[model samples]
Target: MRKSTASPAKRINFKPSVAKVIRERVDGKCSVPRCKNAIRGPAAKGTGSINLGVASHIYSAALGGPRGQGGMDNAFIASAENGLWCCQIHGSAIDKNAGEGYPPEQLFAWKALAEARASKLITDTPSPLGWVDAIQLLRFPHATTLPRLELSRCTLVAGVTASGQTSLLDLAGAVTQSAYAQRFIQREPSTSRVPFVEGRLTYATVDALDRSVDVQVLGDDIHRILEGKPCLLPPGDIQVIYTTLNDLQARPHEDDVAFLLRLLGVDRSALKAIANAIDLRLAPGPLRFRDGVEEDDHGVSHPRRTPSGERYVEAFCEIRTDELPAEVTLNGLSTSQQRGVILALLIAKAQQISQERLTLLIVEDLIVNFDSSKFMQLLAVLGEMPFQVLVAVPPARHNELLEECAGVATLKPNPDLSSWRLRWLGAPIQDSSPSVRRSGVQGSRAPIAKLL
Candidate 1:
């Protein structure tokens, strides 16, 4: 009898286009969770590019290979759907020990997450709308028009209690028509003078031409002017979020943890990342549903109604943090600590929610209660964020705040009964005189800035 020879298993390889598509789908980043290393960049010579990514097979192309073929069709096994983009390191690591470390389910999850993140980046990245380079008061209280205050990426406005620190922040919010602007701005009772705030928004056009738009807010009216002409429609890409220290403080009848979770889009992973970034630990308790239903005498279920005859349902998870004792609620933390948590949560929410719009974050009283080191750490974080940050600090902390800020705007009440004097410090001024010198006073620091 002749010896029988068995046929070798067919091996299917990914086509070039299929591999390219797999890599492009994830924006050329590794499809490993928390290992999204950029795989392509300029080479050493600068004439060509270097690629450190691999289009790895989810299931091996041949039998007896890592993540064996498992009898999958040759066409499907070689398609882009079966491929995962990964850095060279992860590509090898995943296949070690016959792919025992990483299961197919885990790889699929990573691929889905990576693709979702890439899609979000494409959708959320907005066009550039420029920055607020200068602002001038139009008809604010106690002043008609002040000097055109120049703004930097990180501008510090420092003043005493009644010296217009909050007023300046309010003007910024009003100019941008932030959601909380109306509530924060003090309305003039007499209505004799309409308050107005105007700011210069400078941005580059598609042709690389430098252009500026003047955004004016007069009382209840808001408009944009370009090239000395009023634009019929204002640009809709700008977004502003304003929060005061008081806003960060816990409110009666409001659950801080629940509100924070909602603000973060109920994404516990994101909340955990934020907690880690802020040096805090988070342990979310089991979810609870309450006040949604009730049992009657007949054992029949019925919807629960409030005293006002409105049915309501509530579900929440108790978020425990290291800031307070395990037994104590979030309110048990100090006022400053509570404010810090709220501010950090807001920052995280802003980062997750909006990436395409021109965002301006106006914050008040951020430097209160934090020691110098902690305050500096917060400043460093703010500086690294992808946005313009404007902080309002007391005149006394100007020196410390100035170290991290691009420039400082000192608001001082005039010696006489006149308008406030705006002095620019740490920034070069054409005219350097004693009249524009800095001042000294102890107060709180608040951050007001923009983000991309």
Candidate 2:
């Protein structure tokens, strides 16, 4: 073997003119979608400005740099075409871990989207609503004072059994009046009546409209107040979809196929397209539909009729597994596999929906059923989604979850277990403790009311 000493490729640095051009293309905003952070702002001192923008290289400038080592001309690598403008936070994020996860193709797509948005904004077009930043819980059961849980693009709520994990999720659903939460509340008589619970929601709307409105829930009613004045609605409509273990469990009347199709708001053709788009494989065989016969209580075949007096034929998904000698329905899969399928369906639905209104997905104890590898695969799929996500997990995976999520809210019961205490790990925010306190009784308001 001959030892040939070859020097490493020299780094290519972008010129000042090229950097300026890249930043101006996005109008000094971060290139990451929905993260329109102003990279340059007025300084606190007199007559000055601060620049927090970074002209990052889409491709590596040096042989060993992140996303580097691609064979390209030095001149092209240092040109403005290879540069992207991002805020300090995102610029650092895209280069972390030698760019193991962030690929050049995704970066190119983000660059194109940012440029398009900037161009549209120049024509006086309004931007879309941003994600929910934080939610404050003033009053709730089994908690003396609950802190404001600051939400990021992705958040994890990790706690032990009976440590208020479900309570937090329920409060979120109840406050938003989500369909799933309403179903749970109606089923459980104890949760139907809430004496008095007041909280504030902080978010941003179009044209940089930052808002924080207080929402009061009394029994089965909800009230919204904005800037000390009663309002009919929040700044914008927030579509929330929350899923619990009950949603994944088998139902007597409806099977998983029908339940998932309804929740996704799509037909069988669209379902197949979604499954293929995400490259999700549930079992060894493709999903197929077949005619099923209905059975009466006595295990006898019964001829069911539709509203039009026609024969009703049941349809179910036939899945094949290694353990089973014959094919079985989706219900026959393990609980963990079923949950994975549900998550995939939700992700597909999120992708199909429009981005005009902010959408949020909340799942309780999603980590309880799957192994670490499967959980990580689902988490990676969620990372590419367009909306916000909040997942609750058990305490056993808190440490591991913390590393993957933008932030982690750890819930713990107090000494006497009368209330719960929350602690946030990761990210910096204005307040990390509970502030507002409520104690009183109020008459129940109407289900829906107009602003006076």
Candidate 3:
């Protein structure tokens, strides 16, 4: 079977301020020459009048919209310069002829004339609206082709083990962080467009700020942040926390109480809550993590050792709660217990961060040790936090999660699991249907490209 490979086109959203500017410039009238009719009038019931003017794009606002955006910079394609306010009749008329009846140059001329006239009638310009915050789209380059995945408030991704679910989270985190840094922090050119790693890795993205950037350019830098190392991030940049088997394990060097106190802060009440949430016994004593190799009452050491030919020693970071005689290692904890503790800690950390920041929590192999009841508890706890979460469960539990998730993406793995077909919540992996005819195609003409 031939592999499916195609990259999705980048989707851009026009800033609200840009649209407001265009409408105000025309004094809320249609921008057609000698047809500048007032498009706003008093509503039948409401005190404020209704607005009938449409904020139309000079070039296509979307890749698949009428007049199809042709090789234009994604940044300017949705800016103020590309906008025109026209009444319903003329607006529909202009976009109807497959973009042949009225070209971009003609629309620009109309906009100029309308705004020039408005300058005489109006004294002060209207204040603009700020951009709204949200994750609108994600574009991925698969081999030589590019495909995109649209995002909702919350997205759930499910697949069999090793289906690249965690990798997707990594990609999203990296791309978003890079763009955030470039647009908000650094005034000069950012490394967001530079290639950081090799292979088939290259991706670009657009954010709420209408900032477009190639996120994969900061690939390695993003990886470092994931590893818990220090990297410069813009204020309010996304905080990403990922947990695999290794992360679930308790380290021998980490004192449970001390670690919690440091990571969760020195708040005494918070420490008690963390301990209770993880079902750890709270004993009154000094806070310290004991070595797993320490002999118990039976005089036998419980430290885990590596299977090296000649060397056998404590090679894992395993910790024991002060109140428990037995050691508590990530490997020894029940699947549900491990998930509970990890999630609790991460959510707490996210809450402690600035409200302006965003958090992403990713869990792979989610259902390994969870039953239906435990999984539901996990979901309930997650719903309470503001952090964005990506959980990967096996196919057996896929349908169940779909019912409760905001959006879902399913993966159909290849024989070797090296590649997989992705299907959005209710759509097929590939769009095999014929393209539907777009509205407003009167006549065909050479596609016009313009930059804002």
Winner by TM-score: 2
Residues 291-357, candidate 2, lDDT per residue (tens digit)?
A: 5556988999866655445554343334545666455455555667656666766666665552757
What tens-digit string does per-residue lDDT give for candidate 3 at 326-429? 54553455656655565555555554541445455555443456666665555555545555554545344554433322343433332322221222322222
State TM-scores per candidate.
0.45, 0.51, 0.40
Clashes of each: 10, 0, 18
Q: What lDDT, from 0 to 1, does candidate 1 have?
A: 0.54
Regarding TM-score, does 1 or 2 come out ahead?
Answer: 2
Top of the candidates by lDDT: 2
Question: After superposition on all CA atoms, what RMSD does each candidate show versus the true structure?
Answer: 19.2, 18.3, 19.1
lDDT of each: 0.54, 0.57, 0.45
| lDDT score for candidate 2 against the true structure | 0.57
- For model 2, the stretches where C-alpha displacement exceeds 4 angstroms are 1-129, 160-163, 175-195, 212-215, 222-237, 249-251, 255-258, 261-288, 294-327, 399-452
Candidate 1: C-alpha RMSD to true structure equals: 19.2
Tell me the lDDT of model 2 at 269.
84
Worst 10 residues of 2 by lDDT: 438-447
